[model samples]
Target chain A: MTQTKIDGRAKTREIKRKANLNLLERLYLPEIFKGLSITFRQIFKPKFTFEYPDVKWQPPASFRGRPVLVVDDETGVERCVACGLCARVCPALAIEVVADETELDKERYPKKFEINMLRCIYCGLCEEVCPEEAIVMSKEYELVFTSREEAIFGKDKLLTPASKLKDRLEFLRKMR
Target chain B: MESILIAILKAIIFILLFLTFSAVLTYVERRISAFIQDRLGPNRVGPFGLFQPIADVVKIIFKEEIIPANADRTLHTLAPIISLFVAYSVFAVLPIGEKLVIDGKEIKLVLADVNVGFLYILALSSLGVYGVTLSGWSSNNKYSLLGALRASAQMISYELSLGLSLVGVVLVSGSIQIDEIIRSQANVWNIFYQPVGFIIFLVSVFAETNRLPFDLPEAEPELVAGYHTEYSGMKFGAFYLAEYTNIITASLLVTAFFLGGWYFPFVDIYSGLNPNLSAILQVIVFFGKASLIIFLFMLVRWTLPRFRYDQLMRLGWQVLLPLALLNVLVTGLVKILL
Candidate 1:
């Protein structure tokens, strides 16, 4: 037969230990002085408060902002080349593209492209899957709009100047 | 008519002083608590946060007031006013310094030198419970009601011990007048004579003011916001102001009764000094005693863990009450024997 276990003694010992701890806390004289000393020290210390609006906190270095499709400034044409990679990789199914034949290059180009930013997860997956290096994530955090329809960016809102990145970096540095 | 006018002027000055002290106490409480915790407190508002209380006042005044629809409007409004008024009223008889003569006439620092000043303070302190109770009841919230009940019960229970503890002092002084008691304590001080009574009184005062280690009613983790749960803006500020004023008043009463008010030890050695200089020295001594008591009160507030509701009640009824009675009985017996 297996040896019978006796848990009662172990439990009793644990209870006894807890009881002693309680008694020690109650009887300790230095503990009282230590507690009082904390309040006394805090009395003359400066309060931590920041006046908002006039003094805004700079966002963390790695903070991700709104995603945007990049355009080549010299070419001044559609850089997407109807790759369909962004639409496939999008987790929220927010990006859509319609392919059509272009007159200049005779290559399939996007006739209708739309990104429902309200549904966009901003995970940078769209930028990751781009083969032509057309789309890149932007650092525009202040993305407020009056209406939901206005928030859904089409080809028009996605087409931002390439030099906008240099200006954004400087602005972020100045905020720091 | 002239006497009445002078009395009004004195009262106004006293109220202003009390208000100023109460406000400064807020700053002191935060700074002292911070220092004990090994951190710097509010020092940015003004030099060493001297104007922090004023800034707090402005913020509270400007904050949008929110009144709950279910709350009893009249009682909710009246509660804080009652608390502040009672707290302020206790200082009317509190002597900050002895009388002085500018040209010929003697002017007392105190607003009133009433014979029943001790009783007046006791009565007003008891009255402070009404504000907590009413605020809790009027809020139509369960937590508020519970907090109110705890506060009222704690105050009422401790008050018996508090009043009894002081009986030893009153008996020895043979007068209910605070001024008379202080004058009697000039030579020896009541602390030496009635040590047990003084301890009981100090404990009971902590309970009476609903301060830390005795602050069951406003236990933040358990009760959320406690008695003034629904109060907002200036209303909440009133309760805060009342609390600090009550603390200052408790300090003043302790100094006057136990530490020998306005009396410096071995001052007779300076007999050759001018009478005016002596009076100034006495005033300094009185304020010094008061400051020590205030600092001790703040220290104790941070040191002890708040008693559980049952423990608080047990201490008040079983421990302190019995001890106060015994102190009084022993004092009475000693007086008779001597």
Candidate 2:
């Protein structure tokens, strides 16, 4: 408390003194005219407003919007190895995975994969923990759901073609 | 009989014109303020948001009228009506143009050609205090009462300088009639002759209209919404309309008194032009000048920050009053000597 008090006093002493005004500046009318001219000029300056609904902003690859599962273009199948690491690492406990035996080369598949989007905090922890690089954040931020059940995104809604997620995957690789 | 009919017709037309002008003024003020602040204001309602005021009126009319349970109902209802009445009535004596000769009969371009137009305006504008005061008192809200008190005090203080400043014009013109005052400025504007008086009047007019730098009555930060805090729905709309109407009236008064109403400088009015054509041109010129003053009012509002209550009172009583008295004294002396 004593240290802070001394610092506060020093801070007060360090404050810059305001410049004294001359006779013309003290009159106020001239200064008002000066201010008015400034504002008048500002009226012709380019406005910074975005008509939101008419022109949607396209987020960059670095933007972490909503998480989705990536599907390989050649195989037409999700890249998930059903490792359950994402489910374990998710702080929100939003992800769920049920692994089962598969005939495919991966030898394991997710019988059930779902993400409760409402519970998602968009921390990208699931994406970071995934070994197979199955899940990544997409640029789909406008998430609206009428019911709680509808907010639980199943595999069908979570899957996105790899071509659409090229930017995020490339960005992740570069960052890594 | 026909003269009375014409007078009534003229009053109706002027009232409609004022109402429309006030609405458009709101849109213009919003758009200009937005531009100054680097934003696009209300552009969706119509072309360049021209119909925004119409939409606002519709929305306000349909809103739920909320009155405090402990409020005085009668006074609450009467308050806005009083405000609207005072605002509309003040425009009656303001002449827009010179006389027009139609069908061998000369018709004056004023709703009422009363000789004491100056005093009439002062008296009516003073009466506007009742609407604000009564509304504040009847609302039973602390903020509203404080706002009302500030309004009344401010008006009383500034009205002195306002009247005294205009006294210089009355001295020069030798009449309390507004049209006569305008006529006296045919040679040179009052702004040139009575520059000090014009400044005093201009400042007082800002205070009188409760505009910024003198808008303690409706200081949103201190008072919730000032005297109109408790008002809602079309009742609130009435106060809003009255406020803008006062702005228009003040602008017109400034233009007529200082800027030389209906007189285009360096353009001889009697220079071989048709009387009707000249009259129409004069009316257009008068409105154009008034519009410029109104634009100035809006610009000043956006430019200046509100003064502290103490600062406002000090400026009104100590500064403006003294200057106005000196202006009147000088004008009187000059008139007597010259």
lDDT string for model 1 (A32-72, tens) is: 77766765666656655454445565554344567666666
Worst 10 residues of 2 chain A by lDDT: A1-10
Q: Which stretches of candidate 1 lie over 4 Å from their true place?
A: A1-30, A38-176, B27-52, B55-77, B171-175, B184-189, B192-195, B233-236, B263-303, B329-338
DockQ of each: 0.29, 0.85
| Prediction 2 global C-alpha lDDT | 0.92
The CAPRI quality class of candidate 2 comes to: high
Lowest lDDT 10-residue stretch of candidate 1 chain A: A10-19
All candidates: TM-score = 0.73, 0.95
Best by TM-score: 2
Q: Residue B58: error of model 2 in Å?
A: 1.3
For every model in order, what is the number of clashing pairs?
29, 0
iRMS, all models: 4.5, 0.6
Best by DockQ: 2
Candidate 2 chain B: 10-residue stretch with minimal lDDT: B265-274
- lDDT (10s digit) by residue, model 1, range B196-221: 88888888888988888888888888
Deviation from native of the Cα of residue A81 in model 2, angstroms: 2.6
